[model samples]
Target: MNHFQDYTNNRSRLARIDASLFFAPTSCTPLENSVLWIAGCRPSSFIRFAYALSGLDIQFHLTDFLEGKRIGDLTTQQMTKFDELQGETIRKERNLCSRLASLQEDIVDQPFASKIFTSKNYEEEDHHYQFENADEALDEHSQHMAGVMEEADELRMKTLKQIVINILEPVQAVEYLAAAKRMRLCFQQWGKKRDHHHSNKLD
Candidate 1:
């Protein structure tokens, strides 16, 4: 496949999640921006993960703001604040993902390796070819990487607290938290399944 097709295919995946970052024009490729969306995973799964992390209402509308529609439920002040915090959370994640991208350089754009079930030897080796010397790079970027990940995590929590948790009734927040936890499991499983499919594709 041509480089252009690969880029379009990758960007289309992220756009589905509303998780797509300021892309292409950035120093990184589109696939680099979409590290959070593992190859072969459905965009809905990533969206579910994002929804859970943000603690937004089960039916929370992301495209509402993107489409320039005023959020019917939020006051003008509330909508503006939500946009600001939400934007901050997304930026932090994009920053962290980009920082972590280098550690994953070899994972994408490599020829697929066949899964050899005939012998268990492949298991002993890195079948996925991911994260080779990731630690060294992480150590090299340690200072910058550490702060970026921490800021991303903290900002997500802060935004979630302000826009969703703090505004919700105590009982509702508890229920939402429980549901989010369940959704997290689903997201993890979806990621694993996608990874397996990706492995096949590479082969």
Candidate 2:
């Protein structure tokens, strides 16, 4: 129950942050913008996020064992159930990925009218490519992609919530959530530093 409350509070905080970032992007630092980009400017790759969480889970278990702590310990049955959930989640993610790939193919395979002119009478214009009804086609495709990506993001959150609320104990869930947040923050910071380093090298 406490974890759920914390989640709700965090969601509200994030909503405010998102609003601020969108409405006043100039006020945000370059590192903040870069972190947001690294975190996915459009739809995030939920599968990759899930894998990272799985790695964290392993590390958490190993850490607990090393510290001889009884807290945040999962039983054999819980572990088995988590494995099943992971498999199911991956299957759903794969379907979403396939849909995205198909949409990409549709755009890539689309045929456009093209012409080439070699004559000097053409005002030096050499080539032209015309895509009829491209706007409508692209708008529809974008809508479809948005819907699929929204569904995927929702699924990702739902799965994480289920794991924290339904599968893990309250204490364990709290610890896991904290660790996950830390990991995400660390990743963002590291990504920002790496981008800065690369930019300096390019200069």
Candidate 3:
């Protein structure tokens, strides 16, 4: 019951933070800019994010399990099962990462910029690039990127759900999810403070 209550409270707090993220300002703050650069403003980053979260989760779980064992709340058998699940999860995430990378490479190989550059007209050392069909090519690229992003996001959600449902007890799942949310919220708050501090320094 206490665990459930902690999960519920954390879940509510996370929900509020999520809402704030959704309504966050359009203009990129310093932190947002860095995130965009690292994430490449792409949906494929979802897989990477999931992989990172899983790593953190595994670390936390291992620490907790060690403590539980000391307190006689967890058994070696449970730890063994967790080890197997963790291995499987890492393998799956790596496969997905490889597949996404390949798809992104395919998209990049046939860039719209190439199409526009190849259509360049030159006369007497004067050159002008023709963008004929460039828009159409760009649109196609956008569609492909959107599709990949959607696929990545779906996989991320599915993987997380599977980990929670299959590998964790109900209470443990809730607590793990709550902790993940709290981590994200802390990062968000910290980023905002960092940005504010920088802005004040510039003033």
Query: What is the TM-score of candidate 2?
Result: 0.62
- Please list the C-alpha lDDT of all candidates, in the order they appear: 0.44, 0.53, 0.48
Question: Model 2 off-target regions past 4 Å?
Answer: 1-71, 111-124, 128-133
Candidate rank order under lDDT: 2, 3, 1
Q: lDDT at 64 for candidate 1?
A: 38
Which residue runs of candidate 1 sit more than 4 Å off their true CA positions?
Answer: 1-81, 91-138, 192-203
Q: How well is each residue in 1-203 modelled by candidate 3, as lDDT tens digits? A: 34534643553444333322322335545565566411223233332333343443354453342332211233455456555655665665566567657755764576644654453533335555545565565556445444444444444455465545664567656655665555456567778899889989999
What would the TM-scores of all predictions be? 0.38, 0.62, 0.54
For residue 81, give model 1's deviation from the true position in Å.
4.9
lDDT for each residue of candidate 1 in 1-29, tens digit (9 for 90 to 100): 14424554554544443322322225433
Which of candidates 1 and 3 is the stronger one according to TM-score? 3
Candidate 1, position 28, lDDT:
36
RMSD of each: 15.9, 7.7, 9.2
lDDT of 2 by residue, 1-203 (tens): 45644754554455433422332246444665654421222222332333344443464453443233223446776667677777787777678778877866876554311212224324535454332445555557656655554555456567776676777778766666665566556566766787789899999
